[model samples]
Target chain A: MKAFISKNKWTLLLLIAATALMLVLAQKTYYALIIALFGIYAIVATSLDVLFGYTGQISLGHAGLFAIGAYSSALLTIKFGVPSLLSLVLGSAITALIGALIAIPASKLVKHFLSLLMIAFGQIIYLIINSWTEVTGGSLGIMNIPYLNVFGFEVNSNLKGAIVIWVILAIVLLVKHRIIRSRVGNAFIAIRENTVAARGLGIDVQKYKVLAFAVSAAMTGLAGGLYAFLRGFISPETFNGTQSVLFMTMLLFGGITTLAGPVIGAIVLLLFKEVFQTFSTYQGLIYALFMLLVLFFFPNGIIGLYKSGKTAVMKLLSKRAEATRNGGAENAEN
Target chain B: MLKIDHVSMVFGGLTANNDVCAEVHKGEIFGLIGPNGAGKTTLFNVISGFYKPTAGKVIFNGEEIQGKLSNQIAQKGIARTYQNINLFKKMTVLENVLVGCHTQTRANIFDAIFNTKRSRAEHEEAIRRCREVLEFMGIGHLEDSLAGSLPYGDQRRLEIARALVSNPKLLLLDEPAAGMNLTEKDILTDTILKIRDLGYTVLIVEHNMKLVMKVCDRICVLNHGNKLAEGTPEEIQNNPDVIKAYLGGAK
Candidate 1:
C-alpha cells in the first residue's frame, strides 16, 4: 500500500541510495574483492533479520545451514559434475528442507531452548563436515570450486562477482521490503507480539514460525551458494557457531526492526572486519563489546539514532521559527 | 451459530471450568456474565479454540471444532479479542488491522517479492478496509499512530476494529468495556449493536452490567464454572441465582 511505502519513505530512500553507492564503489580492486564477500554476508544477515527482527525467533545454528549449502553446492558441482546453477538451486533446496526439519522442533521451543537446538544443530553439521572426509575432504576443505557462470559467461572475477552478488542482494532486499509491508509481514509481527492473541485473530502461529525460520535459512543458503562460487573454496570453519553469532550481531547493530537494518549492519561490521583483519584474533571480543554498547544505549540500532536526531532538529527549527514570529507579532501589536 | 455442549476444562487437578453449555443463535448479541473466577473467560477460550475442553463438543456452523487450532476456528469465521488488549504494540493501528486481513487476502512469497499487480491491489484493499473499520470504530484519525500509543478507549476500539476487519461470523469480546467511562460504555453499546446489524453474531463476556444489560439480546449467567441461568436482560435481572452469585446473597 502507498501508506506503507509513504511512511517508510526516508528509510527506503536511505537504503536505495546506500545500495547504489555501494554498487558503484564496489568495482575497484581491494573494494570489489572484499565487498563481494560483504554482500554475501549481508544477504545472510538480512535472512537472520527475518527470524530475529520480524518473527521474534532466534537461530544460533544458521551457520549449519550455511555450511550445508556451501558444501552441497560446491561438492555437487565439483564431484557429481552437476552444473553450477542447478547445484546452487539444489543447495538452497536442501538447506530449506533442513531448516524446516529443525523448525518442527524449534517452533515449539521458546527462546533459550530454541537457541540451544540451533546451536546443537550447528555443532552437528560441524561434526559431519569434520568426519565425512572422503566426501567433504574433511578439514582440507573443497578446492577448485567453479566461479559462477551463467549460460557460458564467467562472472568469477572480483568486480563481476561483486556485481552478481549485489544484484541478488538488490532483488532479495526489494522482495523482503515488500513482504515486510504486506499482510504476511503484519501476521509475522502479530505472532511476535502475542502468540495467543495472534492465534485468536486467526493466525497460525506455529506455521508462521516455521515459515520465518525456513525463509531465513533459505536466504542464508542462497548466500552460501554465492559464497561458494565467490571464494572458490569451502571449509567447516567458515560456517560455524561463531559465524552465526556474527550474523545476529550484524542484525542488531543495524537496527533489527528496520528493513535495511541487517543489510546496513552487515556492511558496517563487514567493512570493519576487512579493515581490521590485523586484529582478527580480537574480532570476537570487539564484536561482543560493540554489541554490549549497542544494547545498552542504541538498542534500536543506527536507524533509531538517525530518527532521534531528525526529531531533535525539527523541534529546534520549529521552536526558533515560533520565537521569531512571536517577537514580530508583539512588535507589530505595540 | 455456536453450540457449546458439556464443555469442561481441567488444568492439572484444578478444574478451571466445569461442564458449561450455551447456544448463541444467529444475529444476536449474546452476553456471558459472572463474578471473578467464574470461568466466563475459560468458556470464551474453549469456544475460541484457545483451550481444549476436558470433555465436550463445540459445534460452530455444524462443524465439530472442539480441538481444532485457534487460527483454524478463526478461519471458520470466528474472531475474538482478549481480556487484556493484545495489539501489536509497535505496529501502526492500520498495520494491526491489516494483520486481521490475513485470511481474506492471498499474496504468496513470490507476489510479495515481485510486488505483483494482484498483491498490490490486495494490499490497497486491506488498507482501505482497515480505514473503513477504524472509521466505523471512531478511530480513523489514529490509523498511523502506534497501537501502544493510543488512548485507553481508542486501544479498545482498535482491538474491535482489528477483529471486525477479518469479517468474522462470530466476534467474541472479553470484557469489551472493562475500563470505559459512561460515555465510552454508551459508544461501545452502540458499536456492538452496529456490529450485530452488519450480520455479525457477537458474544461478550463482561462484568459491566450497564453496558451488558443495554446491549445483549440474550444473557447467560455463569457462576463457579457452571451456567446459573439464561434469558433476556430483564429476565436475567430478575433471576435470583445471578443476584445471589453476584452480591453473595439473594434479595
Candidate 2:
C-alpha cells in the first residue's frame, strides 16, 4: 500500500485538487454549467478510451449513442412520465443494446474500415433523428427536459446539477481505475495488443469486443441523459458526425493512454472552445489545427508526451549516477 | 491426450495441412519435425484452433474440438506458444503471465468495477500463480520489465511461463528452439522435459533435430502437409523417408 501510494501520489493529488477546484467554481452557477459540460464530455471521452485505447476499437458513432440516451431519457420523462433516474438507466440500457448490435457487424472489418463503419452508423442515426419527426421532434429536437430529482433533492440549480454530474464523472473515473487492473482489463489490453495471441490464451475475443462496446455506449448514454437534463434541450444537430469527431479529438488531445487522459482531454478542449467562443465561427478549423498539431507533436497524446519527458530526465540522472560508479553499472529499467 | 484424425486445412487453393493424422498420448514429449513449408506449424494451428480444418476431427481428452474457436479450445486445458514471439510488447512480464490466467479467473465486469471481494481474491490468486510460473521458468526477476525488452531467450521463457500459468493439460510449443544458441537450446530441452514431468502433454515442433532427438519421447515427421512417418527419435533418424524429406540424407 505504501509503495502504491508513493507511485500514484501525483494522480491522487491531482484528483483532489480538481475536486477542490470544482467546488470553488460551483459558487457561480454559470461557471458550474460549463464545469458540468466539461464533466459530461469527460465521461464520454473516458468511455471512448476504454474502446480505443484499451480494446483497440474505434467508434465515430458514439454521438449516435449520445443522442439515443438524450432522446430516450427525454421521451420517457415527457411522454411516459417515468422517474428521471429510472429513465436514465433504461436509456443507457437501450443505447448499450444498440451499440452491441452494431459491434457484431462492425468487428468484422479491419482498422480504418471499422472506423468508417462507425461513421456510417453515426450518419444513419442522425438521418433517423432528422426524419423521425413524430418521436424526435426532427432537427428541432426535444425540449423542456425535466430537472433531476435525486431522492427528492432537487437538482434545479447549475451548482447542484454540476455537482451531480461531476460526482458521476468521479465515480466513473474510479470505476475505470479499478477495472484497468482487473481480469477484464487484462483481457481488453490483450485483445488490443494481439487478437490472435489473446485467443491463444482462452479469451473469447468477440464477446469481449461486444462487451467493450456495450460498456462504452452505456457510459456515453448516461452522460447524454445528464446533458439533456442539464441543458433542458437537445438537437439532432448536436449529435452529428462533427460532434463525434469532437469527442474523439478531446480523447486524443488529452491522452488516451492514461487514466486521467480523457478527463484532462475533455476539460482542456471544452474550456479551450469556451475561451475562444468569439471565434466560434472558425471552431472546426481551430479543432483541426489543434488536432494536427497534437498528431505531429504528441501522437501518443499529452500523457504520453509527459511519460517520455520523464523517461528522458530519469535516463539523464541514471547516466550521471553511472558516471559516479565508474560507468560500470547497468542502466536502470522502467 | 490429443488425437488428430485426417485434419486438412485448405487456404483457398493451397492445402496447408492435408489429411494429417497423429495422436499425442499423455505423459510424453511428442515432437513434430519438418523442413520449411512442410506444414508442421499448420498442424499446430489445426490443433490450437487457429485455422478451421477442412476435413476431419481433433479429439482432445475424448472431446471433439474440430469446429471450436481458438479461445474455446484453449479453455479446454490447451495452451500454446507461437512460432514468432508474440508477447504483449508494451505490457510487463508479470502482466503477460497474468493475462494467460484469464480463462481460470471468475471476475465479471461488475466485480471489476466494484472491486468486489470475489474479484480481489481471484486477482491475488492469479498474481501468485503468475509469479510461481515465472520463477519456475527462471525469469522471475524480469517480472517488472516490459516483455519486448527482454533478451530473446528470456522472452521465449516468458511465453512458456505465460502458457504454463493456465495449468494446461496439453501445451503446444511451435519452434521453441528457434533462434536459440546451443546452450539456450540445451536449457530449453531440459525445461520441456521438466514441463512434461509436471504432467503436461507437450507437443513441440522444431527444425533442430539435436534438441528434438535429445528431449522428445516420440517423433512425427511431416512433409508437404502430410504425416510422413511416426516413430521413436532413433527410428526416425534412421528412417530413409524422414531423412529424405527433412534431414536431407543427414545421419
Candidate 3:
C-alpha cells in the first residue's frame, strides 16, 4: 500500500479506477451526482491552490469569477440562443478578461487587506446577480440551458458528467503542475517569498502577481461554466460571498502548498457537509465545529498530519535498522 | 571600469554623499575608508544603482547606470554583496548560486512548457556554473547544504560566489571582513587578490585598516560625506585630515 501510494502517477491511475468502480456500483443516481459536483469543486479548488498555495496570494473573489462564467454561459445559451459548448468556452474567456481587470487593482494591495477587498468584490458580484432582474432573471436564474456534448454524444447523465468534470480538472492540474516546475514558477515563489528580492533579481514583480491572479481566475471561471451546465441552472445564492469563504477555507484546510492538498480538502469538506445533511437543520453548526477543530489541532491541514506521521515512522524504522547494524557488528567482532 | 562624476545625494537636510568623484579601473582593488556615517555605503549604494543621486551620474563601461534598477545594474556587468550577507535562507547553497544565474538563462515559457532540449541545456548550464562558482570559492562540498546552515566564513565566501556567477565586470563588496577573525581575514584577503587576478575590478568598502592597507592599490578617505583625502595607502595613512577623520579616537 505504501509503495503504491508513493508513486504519484500510479496513485492517480488507481484513484481514477476506484472512482469509476464506485460510480458503477453506486445504487442511487444522486450519489453519482454528488461525486460529479465534487469533481467540479475540486477543479476550482485546485486552481485556487495554484495562486494561493504556490504563489502565496490570498484571493477571496474566486466565486466572482465562477459566477461570471456561469452567468455568461447561461445568458448566452438562453437569451442569445447560442450553442452550449461554444457558450461555455466564451464564458471562460470573458471571465478570464474580467479576472485580469480585477487583478490590476487587487494585485497592488497587501495579502490580508487584499482578501478583504476580494470579499467586498464578491459581494458586489452577488448583488449584481440579485438585482439585474432583466438579464440574470432576477435571482430566479435562467433555466433550461442545454447540456454539453462532445463529438455528438450528449453528456447528460451523472456518470458522464463525472467523467467530463474529471477530464477538465486533470487538464487544469496538469497545467498547474507544469507551471510550478518552470522558471515562471520560480519567479512566483520568489515573489511569494520576498518581493523586494524578486525585484532585485530583475523579475517583473507586478506582472507575475497579475498573471497569477488572471490564470487562477480563468481556471476558476472554466470550472464555474462546467458547474452551471452540470446543474442546468444557477442562482445568485449559488455564488454568494459565503461560497467564496468556503472555497478559501477548503484550500487552507488542505495543505496550502501542496498540489494534491486542495482536492483532498474539497473532498473532505464536501463529505462532511454530505454527512451533516443527515442531521438536517444543524449542518451549519456542525461545519463550524469542524472548522474550529481543524484550526485548533491541524492548522496545516490533513497533508501536514500525514507528513509528520510519515517522518516519525521513518525515524523509528531507521533507528531500528541502526540498532540491528550495531548488534551485528558486535557479534562479528566477538 | 566604474566612473562616478560629481555624484551628490542629499537626504532632506543631511547630505549623504556630496559631490563624490572616483574611478575604479579594470583589474584593480580599490579601497574606500571613511568614518562612521560618512556616506561610504551611500556612495556604494549609488554606484550599484540602489539610491539615485540628487545630482551627477555613474557610468560603468561607457554606459550611464545612475538611475537604473539594482538588478538591471547587476545584469549589466555589475554585482554586489551586502554588508549583512543577503542570501536566500530556505534555498540550498547551489540553488542560491543558480538564482544568481537567472539573467544568463534563455529558456522561456515555451521551453518550460514542453521541457524542451533548450530548457534542459539551460538547466544543465546553470548547474555547471553554480558548481564552478562553488568550487572556486572552496565550498563545493557544501553545495547541497542549506544556505542558512553554513558557517559564517562560508556564508561570506558563498556571497562572493553568488555575485561572481553573474560574470560581472565590476564587483562591490561591503565590509567583507567585519566579523572575521585574523585567519579568516587572511583567507579573505587571498580570495580578494585571486578575484582581482580574474580580470574583474573590485570596489571595497571596509573598516579593516590592516587588510585595506595591504590589499588596496589606492585608498580614498571620506569624512562627513565629503572626500577628505585620496592617495596611495602610505600617503593617506600619514595625511592630517585622514588622521583626524579616522585612526583617531573621536568616539
- Determine the backbone clash count of candidate 3: 0
CA lDDT, candidate 1, residue A189 = 83
**lDDT scores of the candidates, listed in order:** 0.87, 0.90, 0.82
Worst 10 residues of 1 chain B by lDDT: B106-115
Residue A231 in candidate 2 has what lDDT? 89
Flag regions of model 3 displaced more than 4 Å: A1-22, A25-27, A76-86, A278-296, A325-334, B181-183, B249-251
Tens-place lDDT per residue, model 2, B139-236, is 99889999989999999999999999999999999998888999998989899989988888999998888899989999998888888999999999
> Per-residue alpha-carbon lDDT of model 2 for A159-269, expressed as tens digits?
898889988998888888888888998999999998899999999988889998998998899998999889899899889887898899999998885777898889899
Residue A221 lDDT, candidate 3, scale 0-100: 84
Q: What tier of docking accuracy does candidate 3 attain?
A: acceptable
Clashing pairs in 2: none
> Could you arrange the candidates by DockQ from highest to lowest?
2, 1, 3
The DockQ assigned to candidate 2 is 0.84
Q: Candidate 1: which pairs clash?
A: none
Which tens-of-lDDT digit does each residue in A1-334 have in candidate 1? 8998999898789768976886687777677877788888889888888888888998888889999889888988998999998888889888888898889889999899989988999999999998899999999889999988877878868888888888888877887887777777877888888788788877888888888887888888889999998889888889767788888888888888776678778988888887898998887797898799789998988877778889999999999999999999999999
Model 2 backbone overlap count: 0
Residue A235's lDDT within candidate 3 is 92
lDDT of 3 by residue, A28-140 (tens): 67877777877778878887887887678888888888999999987888888888888888898888788878888888888899889888888899999999998998789
lDDT of 1 by residue, B1-251 (tens): 89999988998887777888899999999999988998989888888888888999999999999988999998999989989988888888888888888878988767877789999998998889989999999999888899999988899999999899999989999999988888999999899999999999999999889889989999999888888999999999998888888888854
Top-lDDT candidate index: 2
